[model samples]
Target: MTSFSAAQRSRVTMLDVAERAGVSKASVSRFIGDDRALLSDAIALRIEQAIDALGYRPNQMARGLKRGRTRLIGMLVADIRNPYSIAVMHGVETACRQHGYNLVVCNTDRDDEQERQHLAALRAYNIEGLIVNTLGHHLEQLLELQREMPLVLVDRKVDALHSDLVGLDNPLAVRMALEHLEQQGYRDILLVSEVADGTSSRVERLHSFQSQVSLRKDLRGAIQETGPDLHTRLQAFLAQDGAGPKALFCANGIAALACTKALRELGCRLFEDIGLIALDDLDWYPLVGSGITALAQPTQAIGTSAFDCLLKRLRGDTSPTRSLDFAPQLLIRGSTQPL
Candidate 1:
């Protein structure tokens, strides 16, 4: 038996795999990631055997450097703590897996500086595309990135960046909640949302509430921007009023939880003292004091569509930048009805 020298042993490459398997280096490359148009089972098996026999690992860095394509997609989220973002991520990941693409995720915590850092790092990695759930403050940066790579905005929108975007139809969803609450004979309603001026979801939901409520003289509603003070303000509102707003329309899950806490703390029984309705449905919706009425967004569809849009852009099939918005389903429950 003859053993190869150290240098000879180290010199094995994709060419060696091709030679051993009686196939082309291109076949071996395609077999590793399996991203090519198609491959016959026999040819794929040969490549796999050669790779295993030669202890050959695909040199992803070398391939990226040579081809100038990383085959990586970067996903930036404003906050990982949000369930809605997580659901969208699951959609993105599912699509990426099916298409043989790798995803790198970054949490920006809605910070502009962190967002810039993540964008720069993804660029450094030579990522092929990007999916951004942005803070809506970095339009220039996002626009610049979009110019260089295929970009898709998810769940949030940056005003100046003319790119593919997928998000919930916030105004319409809020209107659904408002209409339902009105049907329950709730005249005075209070809309509560997070205190963020630039976030597209919050802004749109607030504006929609104001516009829709203003048209009906009998329906009195006021939008309150709150963060940490959400519970305190809600408690104060409930204490001072004649019969506190007949229904509390929470803009999102966070606000919904705050409203629930405030009501419980004040010993105000839901469905007895006031009605409750929330924008995004929660896991605990059914188990709460009274099941909360909510508008549930189509998270899976949002994610799948976002990936499809990104793939279309990556393939250079850009006819026009598409902005896809999904509507929410209103779930009626005891929280919004009088006991």
Candidate 2:
């Protein structure tokens, strides 16, 4: 019996397959790359038989690199802890797998320095495209990367960088929430949001709230940011005399959780003392007081659209930049019941 080293026994190479198949390495290459039709049927069969007998497998990454394509998409999220990001990520990953691609996700945790670092690391990885759901603080790095590959922005817009955008219609979503609250007989409204921090979505939602409130003479509105002062602000909003009944419009799930915590700490009753409606319907919403009313964004759709945009660009799409704004669906729950 012949003896073989462990490494030799474990490793199977295309060259070995070619030798066994009695063919040139070039013929093997063409066969492995799905160009088998270029060869004679006998040659194809021999290559196939050899491949099966040798248990040969191609290194996809190595092959992709040689062809200047990685089939890898990179996603940069501002805060991975946010439920909204997680939902969007799930959508993107699903689409990637369905399309025979892979996803690389980076979480910046809402830090500017971390965002910069992650961007550089993604570039170094030679990702074929990027999906960003972060405040675009490092413009130079982002612009450089955009020049090299397809870039898509999700839930936020970066100035000076023209690219495809996927997100909810902020103005429409705000209107939906406000209209629902008004119909539910809540006259005083406080829009609670995470500090804008230059996030376009937050700013857009805040602006929409201001403009929409002004148009409704019957409604009184205010804005509050989530922070250590959140509980105190909630107390004041609940205690102060307002238009009629008061309600808090949380801009997103994170804001909804923060505002809920503050309201609870202030010893305020659920919808009885105050009403609540939030953007981004979360799983635990129903478990809370009267099930929090919500303006639910099509998060999965947004994510899938983001990847599709990248795919188009990767496939030589040179069309003009697109802005896809999905509408929100309102879920009426006990929290929004007439007080």
Candidate 3:
């Protein structure tokens, strides 16, 4: 018998597995891919056993290359530190694994130069699709990438690209929160959001709050930016007299954190002196003063749906782009329910 070296013995190809399984290369490929449903139980079983016996690990990148595909997805995030972004990224990762694909994520940290760099890097790697969560400042780069591959936007709307979008229905979510606050005897409302810096979600939430509050004669609503000015603005809001109790509607998790900090510094009782209802549900929401009432955005669903949309486009679906707005589930806790 001829002796084979260690390196030679280590390489176990799908063809070797197919030969051992007494199946064709096409059959092995089918078993490896998403079309295993079309295979007979016996054939599938044989392939499985052969794979285990031969220690076969298919090179997905090589396989994709042969088919003119990369099985790689690129994601651009504005702020990777955001809790909402983390949750959504988890969902997208889970979906990609289930579909036999890989994800490459890039964080711009809300910087335009970083955005341009990340976009170029994603293209250099030959990613099959892209899910954008950045500022979309480099339109020419984005348009060029769009022509090369499928693109989907998450939580932000860039008018130039007009790609598929997945995010919350801000108007409906704002209305629901206001309605809940009104029913809880909170007549005065303050909407706290990050500064309007071309971020679509924040702008939409602010617009919705303003539009809805104007229609209700009994409710008076105002907006505040979450940052260095929040503490002073919040103090002013606390001093304002109203017909009923005052409540704060935080636009997102970042705003919630800022508002909570300011309230703590002011030595105001949490959820007792003034109610707080936030848009994105963070894990710490429960631990903070009898839990903050929240409209929990379906972050995982939004992430998974964004990937699904890109998959469709990758598979030759040239249909019109879609904008999916998932509804938030309102979770009422001790904060919103006055004792």
lDDT of each: 0.82, 0.92, 0.92
Residue pairs in collision within model 2: none
In candidate 1, position 144 carries an lDDT of 76
Off by over 4 Å in 2: 1-12, 20-22, 36-57
Off by over 4 Å in 3: 1-63
- Could you tell which candidate, 1 or 3, scores higher by lDDT? 3
lDDT of 3 by residue, 221-324 (tens): 98988878899999999997876799999999999999999999999999989999999999999999999999999999999999999999999999999999
Pick the TM-score winner: 2
Residues 183-222 of candidate 2: C-alpha lDDT, one tens digit per residue: 8889999999999988999999999999999999999999
lDDT head-to-head 1 vs 2, winner? 2
The C-alpha RMSD of each candidate to the native structure, in angstroms, is 4.3, 3.0, 4.5
- Evaluated at residue 54, the lDDT of candidate 2 is 74
lDDT (Cα, 0-100) at 165 in candidate 1: 87
Q: What is the lDDT of residue 18 in candidate 2?
A: 93
Clashes of each: 0, 0, 0
Highest lDDT: give the candidate number.
2
The superposed Cα distance between candidate 1 and the true structure at residue 241, in angstroms, equals: 3.5
lDDT of 1 by residue, 126-240 (tens): 8888998877576776777788888888877777778888989887887788888877888878898878668887888888888999987768887776667767777766676
Residue 30 CA displacement from its true place in model 2, Å? 3.7
Q: What is the lDDT of residue 209 in candidate 3?
A: 92
- Candidate 1, residue 139: the lDDT equals 70
